[model samples]
Target: MLLLLGLGAWAEKAPAETSRPALTVSVQQVNFVDMERTLSATGNIRPWQDASVSVQTSGLRLKEVFADVGDIVQAGQLLAKFDDTIIRAEIEQTRAAIIQAQASLEQATQNAKRIRRIMGSGAVSQQEADQVLATEKINQAQLSSAQAALVGQEQRLAYTRLLAPYDGVVSAKSAVLGAVYNPGQELFHLIVQNKLQWEASVSSRHLSALEPGTKVLMHVREDLFAEGTVRQQSPALNEQTRQAIVYVDIVPGAQVKAGMFVQGDFKLGTRKVIAVPRQALVLRDGFYYVFVLENNNRVALRKIEIGQSLPNGVEVLAGLVSGEIIVVKGARFLEDGDMVRVALAASETAAGAGSVMSFARAGR
Candidate 1:
């Protein structure tokens, strides 16, 4: 009789021991919050305005280069100089020719006056007077030609010095000292105002949502971001890729550079969403899950569809609802049907203490 009684007692205690809690965790109710809707895209960084600086005169040797790659320059600043020795000699020669032509023209005018005065005076015939007048006219033409030559040489002298067209940063330099360059040969490349833009390629379906003045967040590096605004959108889409280019003007900063490939987000608008702390999520077999607290302190594993990621949490798109209790901490070690000990969070504990004090004061 004693052995049978002891066996029954052991069996009853075994079931109670087996039902112990698997872990201790904190729980909270899911709530709705305002989140911004965004469209993600990837593309390369480019200059807002790429200006090419080229030489206008041919057969001129590059004498000096004052600007180089990565140098900031202002408008009308001299960037380079060409050998003007030959050009200067030509200019002096043209001026001398003009002076000689003027002297000859003065002599011709005096002779023409003398011939007209002598006409019908028995000193010169009418035909001889006409020939003298024609000679004076030829001298006048020669003087005009010499003056035009002088202007042309002076214009060539101005082209010897290369000046910046606008304020910008030099990005490339191909000009070499003592090297002869031809007209239209590009010598320098400038980025106007040192400005940059992110040329992002986005799908055509999302083009309507974008417009000028829309906000953008560019990811320049890890833990770093640059603000941007939509300057314009391409009027047409790529026929092969079906994607359109969105030109985003980034705020001037050192964090971004031209030709860099980066990712960014376009803020379309805002919407209300249900979210939970990041700690409450668990990944299993390529799916995300959360532990939903049920009756009897047991947790049921629930799968969830996630949306945009927030700073401290993630948006729950589906499989969850507001006011549902879920494990906020210590959820990684939990499994389905496991019983857990629900510990009061710090905020809850503080609230409970405040209530106790209030009740004590009321009783007194």
Candidate 2:
């Protein structure tokens, strides 16, 4: 009978140890704070101005190509050259015609002068003097025509040597050596002025908050960031998407390139909020919950509403108070209505003892 009593006592003692708290957890008090509210959007980098470089004068073989795709050029810089042999020969021919016309005019002028002197003395006939004057006028007209032709040929010769119209980076090229091309053919495409901007579109509802000079932060990559400002906003919105575009001017000298897709945020305003560590929140059945410490060292699982996710923590929109203590660590192994041992640091323990001792003296 004594042995039976001992076994029963041991059984009751085992249940007591099993009923102790499952684990110790750290907790933090909720904080009330203010944070910036931002609007995010996606966009692409594009050149502020772009141009299609084409051949103005053609019908000749491409003799040499000096600039290719990805080449940077300045205004009036040589980009390519055509076979100038044909145009150069035409220019020389025009020059010779001008010289011949000049000689003819000079001879005709001398003849008219001689005729004028003889006509008064009856040595030249009236008809002959009139003819000499008319010849002189004809030769003068011929000289003018020849000069105009020479100017046109000279202009065409200049066109044979292709030059860049503005400072830009070559984005495309079609020029091939020893290949004949016609007028208006695109030989190279340039990104004019080498300037880039982000073309981003946002919902029409958020348009009023964004304006010129608003601060923007562009996410170029995981670790890289670029700062920018809103240059302008489109006055109209798309009928289908109901979105408006905004041009953002990013700072130069970044690793960003044209045609790269990027995402960014626009700082609009600020708002007051209450938040807690992200680890303190638990998600189950698509609902978020936090372990709130109650009286008697017990924990109660409380369902909470979550708002925007911040950089360090999450904003709690409802179901929590500013001064409430919630579990910070070791919450994954906990459940509702579980008795817990509040684990306090050395300093916290000292502070708690001091507060209690002061309260006891007041009660006395």
Candidate 3:
């Protein structure tokens, strides 16, 4: 009877020993960080300067177009050509008239010189000599008029070829082949120098944060961030929207174009943050919890309010303090009031500590 009682007590003790099995977990102390706060906004991307190229002379047919929309060109590069048939013919006629005027002036000059020589010898009358001089002056005036006309026609001929005013991409083209165009008509639209900027509309309340050289991030493609800077801010609030415009000069070569709508944000300033490794977080019943390692290796599930999500951890806005130890790994397998054996082996502890330190450095 004594042996049976002893066996029964041993069985009861065996079951009790297995009931509170200790779980091995790795933990780290909460770290404090200073994180920059940002203000969100949406805006349109536009070129820094826009220009409208127009035809200078009237009544010309567009014969050829060397560039189209989206073509990159340089200053003085030909974009379109006008038919120079009529202008060429006019130029040729003016040149012929110049030749005729030159011949007439030369002949009249010779006649005046000969008449003056003979008038001193009494071989030519005074009245006749005066008439020769007058003829010479008339021919000179005619030659001057003809030369001026030639110069004007030559300038008009050069105007037949439309050229780019600056280095830019063709945003729009209105010139059609073989179509007649009038004076001062828009032939093409260009974004001057192909430079682009973001015009973000921010609320007037946050205007103080916006200043020249303030950092900005423009979201061009999904998951793509383009860095920029605030170049200027509007002087007053827009009467309609009660917002001010902030112009951000984007870094060149970003995959962005003018007239594209993009979302962006301005980094206002930084504030203190307390953070823990992401592995330490647990979600149950719409609440975030962390396994805090309490005295005697006991784990306590403490509710937490998480703020910004980081690359390697979550920011702890409330319910946690810096320098507190929390489970960094294997926290999901733990429960409140459970006993845990902290992984204290040299290599294991080093691994955990390294992870936490790396997370802190990255968050900065």
Candidate 4:
């Protein structure tokens, strides 16, 4: 009797559940999204053109400097100079060699003339005169060699002074007056003017939404209010993060500096379509649907097709239209065919304001 009574009680409860009214939910009309789909990434801000400056020769003291960090410089502008005392001395020695070679050449020419006259008069063997002529020709070649060496040495010595490679701002300085820079020592860093790029990463799944020349609005992550475009997308995705790098081109007018890390949004492109608050979309049995109320105050289940998603809402591609009443809040409680009471969004003003205030405080 006790087991039979327990079964009867469970059956009675089942009837109550079945007889209960359907779930109630607020509904929102399908709306179009004004903004396009965009992705965000966080890499770094860098100069579009950055250059490392270095010297080629070693054991030379930086004697003087005319430019420093933050200084605007033009191409070939003198930035610094090194001591050339030893180099000047070497140049002088090379000049002396050239003079000596020329003198020897003159002496050889006179000897050759004497030998030719002797050969014609039969005062010397023709073979001896030929040897003298060859010696004179050798002297002439040696003079030419010496002159070329002097020119090369002078040019190499002139390289001791450093000059700006392009019109840019000096971002770093290493070599100073009296500092000896080793061969290939880095001296200064230059950032070309009006050149900047933003580095950010986006999800690999959203790769289809990304492309070169896509417009992006980038700003510092901490302060998203400040905002730049998708300049380029990396061909390969990051294996660990499943994200890809994107570079945003920033023009000169924007108030941003290279190396200042920032965040930005990308617009995939704009489309006129259906959309609803994410809270309103529900999933059951792996199917997505929304709860709505009919003229009879009965809740209805409406399946929908979703498009691009945004922070505020999801784009509903189908099963809804503008000017149609739909649930915006309290969607989780209602079920299809259930009687539901309609509520106005205006009634939630105080609650929304309070939430906004709380969020603002948390941000601070």
Candidate 5:
């Protein structure tokens, strides 16, 4: 009977002594840290100014194309050329007409002077003198008309050579060799100054915070980013969407092109928030959870609401408070109300005398 009672007592104590912790985990306290706040928006890349280059003269055959699509050109650079053979011939004819008119006017003036001198002497009749004066006036008017016509012809000749109106990149080209183009027909389309802008649609409520000169960061690709500045905002909001257009001028780069849709963020300064290390959180069933350390080395798995992502970790919007001890490492292997062994840091081991009291309480 004594042996039986001793064995029973040993059996009752063996289970507690042999039981082991579920896992060893590192713990940390949640704390507040300053984090940058931003408002996100999506928009398209577009040229700052789109200009069309067209011919101003009619019936001119395209002689040569100097610039094609994607060519960078400076102001007044020749883009294309017309035959100019007909224009040059017309110009020469006009010059000849001007010369003829000048000669006729000189002769008429000399005759008119001679007639005026003889008018009082009766060597020339009054009617003949009047006719000479009138003839001189007619020749003078003819010379003026010819000079104006010569100017018109020279202008036409200049029009045969098409030039860029400003510094830009050629986006389109329609000028073809040997094709006759008429006046006001577009031959090329240019992106003025090769500049680009982002046209972002932002909510009306957020419009008040955006202004000219505000900084912006745009994501061009997975690993690429471009910086931009806010240029202006639409004066009115869209009636149907209640969103306003914000124009942001981007720094010129080869990666960006007009009409490419991209995502971007507007920097609105910073704010303070409670955050934890990224590894401390566990994801399950579309919800995030953290293992909060409870009394007696036990952990409670609690659901948390997350907000903005930070460089150090993620913002915990709810379900956790400051000064709460939470599992940082080995949290995924833990379940609710599981007993754990807290890995003591080097400092805690150094002050083992002070931790003895806490460890004794945890053993219970």
Candidate 6:
């Protein structure tokens, strides 16, 4: 009879041991991170340096253009050509005038010499010598005028063959084959210097945190990316928008072009973050809670101090630790002292996953 009673008691204890809830669980070891707080804004990539080439002189139709839009050109490379018929004619005419002026100057010079000699002999009047000197002056003035005309023609001729101002790619083209353009007109836009800049904006409230050499990340569309440094910042925020402008210089990067739009986190430094993942948080009674797994895999209903909710996760300022696993996939049905499972490893969570959260184990 005693043996039967002992067996019955042992049978009851066995059910208690085997009655523990079976939970599929995952685990992770958490770590503390020192990271920069990135401020993000949308802006454009522009040339760090751009020069607008224009026609300085007006002229007739040209033969053809030697360079086209999007053409890579070097310094002094021929870009376009113009008809030089009028300039050539002008140059020839000026040359002829110079020859005539030279002959006249020679004649007047000899006349003055002859008159001076005769005056010493009392054979010629002083007025005659004076007239000869005036003729010489007139010849000199004529020569100067002809020389100036020839110089002007030469300059016009040089303008016919347009050249790239520097080593750059042609971004735009306005001049075409045999087209005549007026003064101050654009020809070709060049950007091949491969210099690009990113413009970032900061709100008035966060302007004080921005600094020179503050690091930033830029996400160019189509998977093309470029690294740019903060080169300039606006002195004052705009009154209407209340935002400050930041200029970032892009390093030579793959597939990054001038004037392409990009957006990303820019502010670089550490700030306080209240962070948590989507699944671990439960909305109950208009507040957020987590089924925190304790040391021995038991769960407790814990109230979390949250700041902001994000797309991927939430920020938990005061309710978690670095190395605790909170129920990620299924925690909505958990109660105090209930057995729960952590579906994902805390250590395996990526930096972008969300806030770090700790779980408490429940015991019966």
Model 6 TM: 0.77
- Estimate, for each residue in 113-215, the C-alpha lDDT of model 4 and write its tens digit: 9997777787898888888899899989988988898887777687787888888889889876788877788888899764778878778787677677777
Better of 3 and 6 by lDDT: 3
State the RMSD for candidate 4.
Answer: 9.0
RMSD of each: 6.2, 6.9, 7.9, 9.0, 4.8, 6.7
lDDT, model 3? 0.85
TM-score of each: 0.82, 0.78, 0.69, 0.69, 0.82, 0.77
Clashes of 6: 23
Model 5: CA > 4 A from native: 1-22, 110-133, 282-287, 300-303, 330-338, 345-364
**Which candidate achieves the best lDDT against the true structure?**
1
Q: Give the per-residue lDDT digits (tens) of candidate 6, residues 14-42.
A: 97665474454443332344334667787
How far in Å is the alpha carbon of 2 misplaced in model 5?
A: 7.7
Cα lDDT of candidate 4 equals: 0.73
- Which ten residues in a row are the worst by lDDT in model 2? 355-364
Task: For candidate 2, write residues 147-261 as lDDT tens digits.
Answer: 9998888888888888999999998898888988788999988888777788998999888899899989899999999888899988899999999889998876667889999
- Global lDDT of each candidate: 0.89, 0.84, 0.85, 0.73, 0.88, 0.72
Ranked candidates (lDDT, high to low): 1, 5, 3, 2, 4, 6
State in Å the error of residue 142, model 3: 12
lDDT of 1: 0.89
What is candidate 1's lDDT per residue for 227-285, written digit by digit as tens? 89999999999999999999999998758889999999999898999999898999999
Task: In angstroms, give how far residue 14 of model 1 lies from its true place.
Answer: 9.1
Across residues 1-364, which tens digit of lDDT does each residue of candidate 5 receive?
A: 9999999999999888746677766788878889888889999999999989999998888999999899999999999999989878888888898899999999999999889878889788889989999999999999999899888888888999889999999999998899987789999999999999999999999998998998999999999898999999989999999999999999877478898999999998888889988988899999999988888888999999999999889998999898788888778877788888876656766876322111212332
Residue 250, candidate 5: C-alpha displacement in angstroms: 1.6
lDDT of 2 at 198: 89
In model 2, the Cα lDDT at residue 244 comes to: 88
